[model samples]
Target chain A: MPKLWNETIEEHRRAVRDTVLETTAELVAEQGLRGVTMSRIAERSGIGRATLYKYFPDVESIMAAWHERQIAGHLDELADLRGRSDTPGARLAAVLERYAFIQQQRHGHGAELSALLHRGGHAAHAEQHLRHFVRGLLAEGVQAGEVRDDVTPDELTGYCLHALAGAGELPSKAAVRRLVAVTLTGLRPQG
Target chain B: MPKLWNETIEEHRRAVRDTVLETTAELVAEQGLRGVTMSRIAERSGIGRATLYKYFPDVESIMAAWHERQIAGHLDELADLRGRSDTPGARLAAVLERYAFIQQQRHGHGAELSALLHRGGHAAHAEQHLRHFVRGLLAEGVQAGEVRDDVTPDELTGYCLHALAGAGELPSKAAVRRLVAVTLTGLRPQG
Candidate 1:
C-alpha cells in the first residue's frame, strides 16, 4: 500500500476505537455497568458488532480503556495546572483543588461503578503515578520553605491524598475548597 | 412467672443469640459472605434451625446485629480513651489514635462485608454519633487553644475522620499511628 493510504487507514482505525469507547462509557453512565454489552456498544457507536470486536473483545475491555483515558486526561490536566502556577505553593494548591473537584465529580457515579473501575492493575499504576506527581510538588514546596519539613515528602503526599479523599463525600464545591484548605494547612510549618 | 425465673430465661436467650452472631461471623470470615447460610450458622452455633430463626430471621439480620454491636463497642472504646487523658490535646490524640487503629483493624474484614455493613439506618446513626463524639473533643481542644479555631469543629471532625480513614490501607500499626499524627497536625493552629 502507498504511505498516504496506510496513514489514512491507521487514523480511521483510531477514530473507530475512540467511538466505541465513548459509546460504552455513555451506556454505562446512563444504565450502569451491568446493563452494558458488546452489541449495545456496537449499535450505539454505529458500528458493526464484528468491527467493535476487532477493537475490543467485550464491554469490560472498552470500559477499562475509557477509564484509562480518563485517568490520563486528569493527570495531564493536573500537570498543566502545575506548570501554569508561579510558585511551588501556588502550584500545589491549584493541583489539590482540581484533584478534589475530580473526586467530587466521581462521587456522582455510584459506588458499584467506582468500586469496579478502581480495582486491578491499571488503577494501581495510575495511583502510583499520581503519588509520584504529587510527591514532586511537595518536595518543591519544602525546598522553598513553604511546606513543613518535619515529615518526609512521601508521608506528606500520602497525608494530602488521604485527607482530600473526603472531598468525594462533601456536599458542595465550597466544601471541597474548604477541605483543600485544611489539607494545605497541615503542610504548613508548625509554630 | 416469678421474676427470678423470667430473668434466667432472658439471660439464656441472650447467650444463644450471641453464640449465633459469633458463629456467623467466623463462618463468613473463613468462607466469605456468599458461602454463609442460616443452616451453617445454626449448626456452627450448636442450635436448631428453628431456634436460630426465632432470634434472627436470616443471615443478613444476624450480620447486621453483629455489626451494630461492633460499632457500639468501638464508640465506647473511643469515649473511654478520651476520658483517660488529662489534657484536651492529649485526649484528642488518644481518641484519634484509637479511631485510626479501629479503622486499620476493619481493613482485614474484606470489602464486601464492609460495604454491606456500612449502609442503611444503623450505620448512619452510628456515624452521626461518632461525628458528635469527635466534634466535642475538637471543641475542647479549640477552647484550650490546642487546636486551630479558624475552622469550625464540625469541619475539623470531618477532616480528621476522613484523613484517618486512609489508615485502613496502611501496612502496619506504626503507619496507622503516623497517619493519626499527621491528621492531628492538621488541626493545630496555623503559624
Candidate 2:
C-alpha cells in the first residue's frame, strides 16, 4: 500500500475504536454491567460484529480501554490545573475539587458497574499514578507552609484521596467544594 | 402449647438462625459470592435444607441479614468506645482509630466480597448511622475547640469517614494509626 493509504487506515482504525469504546460505556451506564454484550456494543456503535471484534476481544476489554482513557484524561486535566496555579496548596485544592466532581458524576451508576469498571490491574496502576501525583503536590504544599509537616507526604496523600472519595455520594457540586475545602484545612499544620 | 415450651422453641429457633447466618458468612469469605448455595449452607450448618429455607429465602437475603448484624455490632463498638473517653476530641479519635483498624482487617476479604457486602439497603442505613455518630463527635470536638468550627459537623463527619476509608488498603496497623492521626490533624483549626 502507498504511505498515504497506510496513514489513512490507521487514523480510521483509531476513530472506530474510540467510537466503539464510547458506545460500550454508554450501554454499560444505562444498563447494568451484565446487560452489555459484544453484539449490543456492535449495534450501538454502528459497526459490524466482525469489525467490533477487530477492535476489542470482549465487552470487559472494551470497558477497560474506556476506563484507561478516562484515567489518562483525568491525569492530564489535573496536570493542566497544577500548571495554572502558582501556589502549591491552591493547586492541590483545585485538583481535589475537580477529582471530587468527577466522583460525584459516578453516583447512581449502580455498584455492579462501578465494580466492573474498577476491577483488574489497570485500575490499580491508575490509582498509583493518582496517589503519586497528589503526594508530589502535598510535598510542595508542606515546603510552602500551607500543608501540615507532622505527617509524611505519603500519609497525607492517602488522607486527601480517602476524604475526597465521599464526594461520590455527595448531593451537589457545592457539597463537593466544601469537601475539598475541609480536606485542605485538615492538611494545615496544628498550632 | 405451654408457655415454657413456647419459650424453649423460640430460643432454639434463634440459635439455629444465628448458626446458619454465621455459616453462610464464613462460606462467602472463603469463596466468592457466586460459589455459595443454599444446599452448601445447609450442609455446612448441619441443618436440613427445608429448615435453612425457613430462615432465609435465598443467599442474598442471608447476606443482608449477616450484614445487618455486622453493622449493629460495629455501631455498638463505636458507642462503647464513646463512653470510655472523657473528652469529645479524644472519643472521636478513638472511634476513628478503631474504624480504621476494622477496615484494615477487611484487606484480605477480596474485592468481590466487599462489593457483595456493600450492595444493599442495609449498607446505606449503616452508613447513615456511622455518619451521624461521627457528626455528633465532631460537634462535640468543635465545642472543645479541638476541631475546626468553620465547617459544619456534617461536612467534617464526611471528611473523617472518607479519609479513614483508605485504611482498608494500608500495609499495617501502624499505617492505619498514622492515617487516623493525619485525619485528626486535618480536623483541627488552622493555626
Candidate 3:
C-alpha cells in the first residue's frame, strides 16, 4: 500500500478503537456492568460487529481497556500538576487535594461499578504510581522543613493515601477539602 | 406447659441458634458465601432443616444476625476499654490501638467476606457508635489540652478514623502503632 493510504488506515483504526471504548463505558454507566454485551456495544458505537471484534474480544476486555485509559489520563494530569508547581509543599497539597477530589467523584460511579473497575493489573499499577508520586513529594517537603522529618516518606505516603481514602465516602467537595486539610496537619513539623 | 420443660426448651433453642450462626460463618470461611445453603447449614449445625427455618428466614438473614452480634460484641469491648482509668489521651491511644488490631484481624476475613459483612443496618449503627465514641474522646482530649482545639471534634474524629484505617493494610503491629502516632500528632496543638 502507499504511505498515505497506510497512515490513513492506521488513523481510522485508532478512532474506531477509541469510539468502541467510549461507547462501552457509556453503556456501562447507563445500564451497569452486567448489562453490556458486544452486540449492544457495536450497535451503540456505530461500528460493525466484525470490526468491534477486531478491536476487543469481549465486554470485559473493552471495560479493562477503558479503565486503563482512565488511569493513564489521571496520571498524566497529576504529572502536569507536579510540573507546574515549584514548592514541594504546594505541589504535595495540590496533588493531595486533586486526589481527594478524584476519590470524591469516584463515589458517583457506585460501588458495583467501582468493584468492577478497581481490580486486576491496571489498578495495581495505578496504586504503585500514586504511591511513588506522593513519596517523592513528601521527601521534598521534609527537606524543605514543611513536612515532618521524623517519619520516613514511605510511611507518610501510606498515611496520606489511607486517610484520603475516606474522601470517597464524604458528602461534599467541602468535606473532602476539610479531610485533606486535616491530613496535611498530620504531616506538619512537630515543635 | 410445665416450667421445667419450658425452660429446657428455651435453653435448647438458644443453643441451636448459636450453633447455626457459628456453622454458617465456618462454612463461609472454608468455601465462599455462595457455597452455603440452608441444607448445608442445617447439616453442619446438627439440626433438621425444619428447626433451622425457625431461627432464620434465609442465609442472608442469618449472615445479617451474625454481623449484628459481631458489632455488638465490639462495642461492648470498646466500652470496657473506655471505662478504664487513664488520661483522655491515654484512653484514646488504647482505643485506637485496639481498633487497629481489630482491623488487622479483619484481614483474615478476606475482601469478599468483608463486602458481605459490611452491608445493612448493623454496619451503619456500628459506624455511628464508633464516631460518637471517638468524638467524645476527642472532646475530652481537647479539654485536657492534649488534642488541638482548632479543629472540631467531629473533624478530628474523621481524621483519626481515616488515618488509622491504614492499619488494616499495614504489614505489622508496629506499623499500625506508628500510623496511629502520626494521626495523633495531627490532633496535637501547634507550637
lDDT winner: 1
Error of 2 at A151 (Å): 2.7
TM-score of 2: 0.85
The model with the greater DockQ, 2 or 3, is 2
Q: Please give, for residues A1-191, the per-residue lDDT of candidate 2 as tens digits.
A: 46798899999999998999889888987886888999999888899999899888998899889988988998899989999998997898888889889888866676666777787788899899999999999999989988888878998888888899888878878888878877777788755
Model 2, residue B31: distance off in Å is 5.4
- Candidate 1 runs further than 4 Å off: A1-3, A31-40, B1-3, B34-40, B86-88
What is the model-wide C-alpha lDDT for candidate 2?
A: 0.86
List TM-scores for all candidates, in order: 0.87, 0.85, 0.86
All models: lDDT?
A: 0.89, 0.86, 0.87
> Per-residue lDDT tens digits of candidate 1, residues B54-144?
8998888889999999999999999989889999999999999999899888988998898889875899999999999999999999999
RMSD of each: 3.0, 3.4, 3.3
- What would the per-residue lDDT of candidate 2 be over residues B99-148, giving only the tens digit for each residue? 88887786677776666777788898889989888899999999999888
For model 3, report the TM-score of its A chain: 0.94
TM-score of 3: 0.86
lDDT tens readout by residue for model 3, B26-137: 9988888899999999999988999899899999888888888888888788779988948999898888878877777777878877887887878988999999999999
Q: Model 1 over residues A168-187: C-alpha lDDT tens digits?
A: 88888998898898899888
Chain B TM-score (model 3 vs. true structure): 0.91
Error at B177, model 2, angstroms: 2.1
Question: Candidate 2 chain A: worst 10 consecutive residues by lDDT?
Answer: A106-115
* A106 Cα displacement, candidate 1 (Å): 1.4
Stretches > 4 Å off in candidate 2: A1-3, A26-50, A143-145, B1-3, B27-50, B57-60, B143-145
Kindly list the per-residue Cα lDDT of model 3 for residues A1-191, writing each as its tens digit: 45798899999988998999899999988998888899999999998999899888989888888989988998888889988888999999999999988877777788877777777688999999989999999999999999998778999999999889888888888888878888898898876
